[model samples]
Target: MVFRRLLGSMGVGGPQVDTVLAGGAVVPGGTLSGQVCLLGGESAERIEHIGLELLARVEAEHDDGESEGAVVFERFTVGGGFVLGPHEERAVPFSVPVPWETPVTELYGQPLGIVLGVRTELAVAGARDKGDLDPLVVRPLPVQEAVLEALGQLGCGFRSADLEYGHIGGTGQTLPFYQEIELTPAPQYAHAVSEFELTFIASPAGCQVVVEADRRGGLFSSGHDELSRVSLGHADAHTLDWNAEVDGWLRRLTDRPAHQPSLGHQAAPYACAPPVHHDPYGHGAHGHQDPYGHQGHHVDHGHHVGHGHHGHHDPYDRHDGHGSHGSYDSYDPYDKDDDHRSGPGVGTAIAAGAAGLAVGFVGGMVADEIVDEIGDFFDGDDD
Candidate 1:
């Protein structure tokens, strides 16, 4: 019996835990219900506490370059305070509310290459172990879906999506990080802009949409970024003609003069119009100061420019007078190709004049590879 206690102290025969999420994909601001199954080992163990943490793989930009790490955005304590007899089994069920700003991992049943997970930490007798981790699937909210669908209808192709570790100034951002969905410009606007980065901040009251464009340079002019934003209520998703609304926003975004300031900034050309919020840290939002006083606000745009150097040397290898763009040398299932090839070719088809975004295009080899890569990522992190 003494040997068994020593083994338990050493975590050789302690309680084991496994968490299983209740249902299919859940949306942001929705409940995540799951069961934490526990099985006792050779000896009885004192159950101290059980915690569930919501984690996201976020990219951080720093002086040395960029690095990816897991960020625990939320934590919940469900149940504990009991002793589990040897070889016994008990399941603790819990339902917790996810944050309103949780990044969406999928759209229309297709994976967007964003990784999120729920980690179960089991505490026993002063020792804690992360027993289980499950991949989380978050679908876009109605307003978010409508906007992306509208972009697809307008011939914009999905490029990639990632969670950037930083706060966007001038908005009611609750989370420390925000999601950026990259999209290729449609033929009509391709001549003026290279790409568009879309960000949505959702709240119970409404949603804020920020669109940043990589404006193309002329024969003598240098390229720069342009930003615009707008607000919409939940009902507007179904009420407004999204195609027209989104098209108008894009038209104004690309057509604005190079020297003119965008909306929300002081002395912006559209000062008289309803103000649209933007990231003060974003590049080329002329005249706007970083409210956070963050040192590396200029580096955000440079990160996008570094995407071209992917599959080669480290993008952040050289400072080159430009801010540190960082490197994505690690496994990126959604890595963008130089010729603009994307995962599953859904966006390519959409840009090729498909009626709308299709479902289930992520299949066969591409699907298997994505699943394998994501599985390896989470599994390796378990160590």
Candidate 2:
């Protein structure tokens, strides 16, 4: 949605700025384009820069508990260094590359409840103001789709997905948070495993597919989590034997020894177990952040999954907690949602229109309250 507002800090008659995203659900590693419209105020103003920031609502875990916040993951200065004539209007168009590992917000033409956004920042005459925020929708890559389709074909059910704050320890994870896609076990594997999580850390080279399974221990032992890693290339979207490949991973997880002790084991192969909680910290499902588990907080690397020499340590460093939505019915693998969805960017662009934006819209978070309050403060309509 387009957020048009006067640089409130600029005072009466300051410049007006509105940012509109080009419509379309973008895939990871793709491009997001939009236009930032600027109108001169009472007088000509020296504009310094116009920038866009990509933000996502992520959940975090720590000693105290969990809360939520808008995490800025990417930033780009689209246009800048121009002069605004008094009462003149200008539109600065831009296209920026999205991170290769950005989270998938929707699947099967339904919202997975993941919240992402693009906020605009304008710098005028040495003063900068955050103009507005537009909701961002991301679709999976072709390879990601192939892998997920294989799971669906295997009877794996889709649950919930979320972004977790903190590192995954060993992987080449560039973002401060990683996306975790949770799934229910198929009947065949149900006896051996409870559930599993899929994390795809994609890059220009390929995607690092991390399959974490919550295994059901035998009568003699308690259940544990198993982790398996595989490399998937973009080219494999059409070439690889995904079903067979995934089946192989499942076999490995079920046949291997997965759990480690609960103390001091945080390293390479990763602790296959879920931090073991979707809402383990009692934080809301969306944008849940443990206030104590922030950027500076120390993440406890222990959980009830994985195995090791110490028998007290949890492997797979960096706490990654994910939530899930039990299974549902009526799914069409060959659904035409993609064809019917707005062409490439049209849907997303349409969302950028000024109408869809209002109080309690994007992510249904406090950010909306903040934005609406700003608008009302300037419009002088406090009712």
Candidate 3:
């Protein structure tokens, strides 16, 4: 996406700035390289500086209520200090480093509904205008991909993904808001958990995969939430069985109770007794549930569906700060639906559990009926 501006802040015939992000999604902690093209308007002007700001349409909740706004989280001075002649043209190239904490906009090239962007700020002749809004598309880190693919293969279906306003208490979270990718439980886990929320904190060393399970109460009990963090080396992703590991992590987390809170760690609590030992789905025996108990079941391989196909009928919240939010275009590379699929399914195999039950992977398109219902829910709220 390219944003061109006639330096709106300046009078008529000012320089125009347009930023073009090289097409293709970048990985977290990867380099995003592109160019800023500037064209001189009616007269000569002094170019002070050309800057780029990384922004997110983040959700903020306060005492007043819940609202959303554009937050400038990072900035860079790409170029400046020059004179523009009448009708002059210049292209300033840039190679900006994406932050390690950048949110994953897509998985296996599918849109997850997270909005991020790059705004080019041009200062010419003492006037500044952040020209054009280019949509930012980010792919998952290798480890993050392995984990999500594993979950989908494990039978979990994608629910909805959103950016939360606050931090998860016990994380090395650098950003104020964290992205939560929520998933409906696979059949195997349904007895123990109602749903699961996954958050990944990636860094140079590795990523901390935090899984939160909404535990369903037993025969006479009420439900609660449980959280567990698993640290994995990025390289180890290629060598381990992520499905088994993830299943084990869920077992350990759901079977345990509360303990003395780690001094600096804050985690959600569940109804079970404190876990005496870690690693429930271990090298040890993997427990099997009876016919009456909730079992985790994953279905077959599914296709990626576009956001438009989700039947979005609700009106966007145009009043929530910039009117731009309502105009966001959902771009899912895997959603092209052209002649070919992308790169052999990311090289991961999904373990579709039990028969007769439907299965949807994390990045797979949700069933048409369920998607329509969700869209209707949002639409109803507007009325």
Candidate 4:
């Protein structure tokens, strides 16, 4: 998307700014290059500086329920400290490093309903405006892709993915929020668990993969959640069979007690959100909490039927904060048409799981407040 907003703060003859991200998808811990194009208004103007901000549509958990908002996670100053001639056009090329913990917005070149954006900030004559808001397409790092592919092979179909605003207690987690990819259990494990959630915390060395499952209680026991952690070298993703490794981890995790659940859903008390800490790199010395910190709770949307199809409705939450009880960002349960998008299926896979249970989402279109946020964003908001 190209934004050419008249510097409203600059008045009628003020210059206009447009930010253009190089065409293509970016990955976590990767560099995003683009141009900040400025067009001189009626006359020459003093340009203080040009800045770029990386923003994510993040979901937060509160006492009552959940809310989604646009959060600026990273910022960079690309150019400025100069003057522009009347009607002169200048393009400032820039390259910025994306945060290592940035959430993935797409899979195999498809939208995951997680929206990220690059907003351009222009400063002139003591006035600043966050101009263009271009949709940021974050593809998974190679390792992340490999892991998900492995899960696909394991018969775990995609359920949903979202960003949470909190910390996982027992890990090298530095970010204030995290991403969770929820999946339906494969047939073999269906009897033991309902679904599982995966999180990836990446650093220069590698990433920490955290897995949690909702284990159905035995005839006499109520359902509970199991948590496990696996560290994989960036290179290990391509070198090993993640299916077997992941399976082994799950088997071992079953022996541990499950995370405490909330009143309505199974909460991953193991990955609770704590105080907020931002990490663009440079890991500070941090303490580990027992995978016992209850980050936040998952919010659920009731039974949903979409696109002429219906399935069991499963509502979940993803909040990310430091463990004042946080969770992952949310996946819009009412997105009726998301399943029709190209690339990987975010909903049910063609192949059924054990007992012919279909995996993935049933699909739906977004509505209500979600529709407003998205529409205003693309339509251009002065804010």
Candidate 5:
């Protein structure tokens, strides 16, 4: 989608900015190429800088309750330092790298109800305005797709997906938040687990698969959550029999004791293949840093906050000054009280077929409604 908006900070007859992302959905850790079209106002204007921000609709847990807001995950200064004459038009092309942990908004071309957008920020004469907001479409990487396909083959159906604000302790999670893909349990495991949530942290070397199972309670026991982690190389997507591999992982997870702290760095119990081990924090493979120098957890508070470089404070930005590191014990992925909840019979089913899981529409909203919601979100209207 192309979003066109006038630089309102410049008052009437100011320049207009339109950002258009290239066709096709982007994958995590891939490059996002787009063009920012600028139309000069009635008078000459000095453009100081043009910035592009990657924003996600994130949910956070607080002492009072849960709240959803827009989080600026990454930003890039694509163009700047130019003077546009009256009525002149210019197009600034940009090719920026997306963060490896960026959330997937779709699977097989179907919306997962995860909202992400690219907003264009224009600065002129000490005034800045985030004038345009366009919806962002991100598809799963090959490894991610293979994992999900395996779950489908095992009879696990997709429920819903969303971005949660917080860090997963003892993992190489770079982003301030992570994506949770909720799925119903396969028939074989239904007696043991009600559902499970999947999280993928992809880096240059490989991807980390984190699975959290909502296990059913016994006659005298209470239900609890169990989490497991495993590291896999990119090539494993094509080499491993994902159905058998994933089933083994789930069996081990459900059978583990509830009191055990996470299955940290453990290899999956796949007998066909030997244990695959890789460093979880191997960022040195590509020498990558947090894309945004700040832990940009600034909340929009149901409105559009100014895109300034400083003076913005977020109570939820719990990082240690550096954008990359943080430990949040408050954000629980298993909490069901959050406004967004997806359970069995609560969302559109991702039907299992001969090939695998077939793509379906979003759970709550259709395609057109999602577009409208995106417009409303950028317009500062939470309702």
Candidate 6:
């Protein structure tokens, strides 16, 4: 999609600018190529420069409350010091590299609601005008996709995705905010946790997978949050059993002694878990089982599952908080575990199937909205 907006800095009879992004979502650190079209106004004017700005609608949290604003994270000067003849039209094409820390906007082709855009600004004579604004769609890297795909196979469904306004302590976090992909717990593990939230931080070396489980609480025991971090290289993803690996991650996180409290702190063990079972066919069944709970204000990280000692306090065993514990037709093939952790079964299978169906359509919707908005604002005449 493309956006073309007249330059506000110049009254009528000034030049206009329009920008169009290439089709489909680009990956982080990938090149975004597009064209900027300019139409000369009443008479030929000296065009000083043409610039492109990368914009994002980010959430900001403060002591008092929360607010959202459009922020410019990157800028590129594409065409400048040129001349435009009266009634003349020119097209300037550019290929720019996106920042590695760029937040992903889609997965399995689904919209994650992380809005991004490109704005075109033209400087004519001494006046500067903001011309266009369009949406930007970004897909996850290969490794990132593999991990999410694995989770889907494990029976986790896509919950709402959003960007948080705080830095994750004890990690190589470059952005001020991070994106969280929330998921419904698999059936077996449903009794252990209400839900799980996953975050991925990818770099040249490897990607970090952060899992946070909201365990269910029983009487006399308060619920606590468990966090686990793991790192995986591009080569290791295919060989690893993502189901077993993710299950192990949950176990280690939940098993932590409640007495050792680390608020806002992520625990260690930055290694990928080994693969569960190798499938001869490419369609591997690995995902979460439990159905999703009711939608709440935020991904409730406060659900109590089982009890543990934070210090001297003891927590109790619990059920998955996703409404009635009535059993559904098993979707995946995995067996259930005490803490809701299950083997490869119907629960995991169903999650992977649902996410696959939903991601493509959602992703395209978001991509079209973003690109079209940008084109409308940036791609047009400047009179």
Write the residue-wise lDDT of candidate 2 on 48-115 in tens digits: 97877677777776557975556667666777898899878898988666666789876544456567
Reference-based lDDT, residue 77, model 4: 78
Best-matching candidate per TM-score: 5
Q: Write the per-residue lDDT of candidate 5 for residues 123-160, one digit (tens) a residue.
A: 98888888887888887766677788778767787877
lDDT value, residue 319 of candidate 4: 28
Q: What is the lDDT of residue 286 in candidate 4?
A: 25
Per-model TM-score, in order, reads 0.70, 0.69, 0.68, 0.72, 0.74, 0.68
**lDDT, candidate 1, residue 69?**
72
> Mind giving the per-residue lDDT tens digits that candidate 1 earns over 1-383?
11112223436766677787887887765567888888888888888888887778888776688888776676677789999899887889987665657898777566777878787777788977776767888877666777887898788887777888665554456566789888889998898899998898865555678788888877655567766767676556556687898888898877866543334322211111111132212111112222112222111211111121112221112222211112111112122242322223444333432222222233323435655655566655642
What are the Cα lDDT values of the candidates?
A: 0.62, 0.61, 0.59, 0.61, 0.65, 0.58
Error of 5 at 82 (Å): 0.4
Better of 1 and 6 by TM-score: 1
Candidate 5 Cα errors over 4 Å, as ranges: 1-3, 257-364, 381-383
What does candidate 3's lDDT look like per residue over 188-208, in tens digits?
777777888888876555677
Error of 5 at 269 (Å): 22
Off by over 4 Å in 1: 1-10, 260-375, 378-383
Residues 1-383 of candidate 6 have per-residue lDDT tens digits of: 23353546787887777888888777764567899988878878888878777766666665578765555556667788888887688889987656545788765455666767787878888888887766788877655666676677766667766666445544565444567777777675676678888887754445677787776665645455666667665444445566676666766655544433335433322221111221111111112222121112112122223322132211111123211112121221112232222223434443454355345424534445655644543344231
Candidate RMSDs in Å, in order, are 14.1, 13.2, 15.4, 12.0, 13.4, 16.2
The RMSD (Cα, Å) of candidate 1 is 14.1
Ordering by TM-score: 5, 4, 1, 2, 3, 6
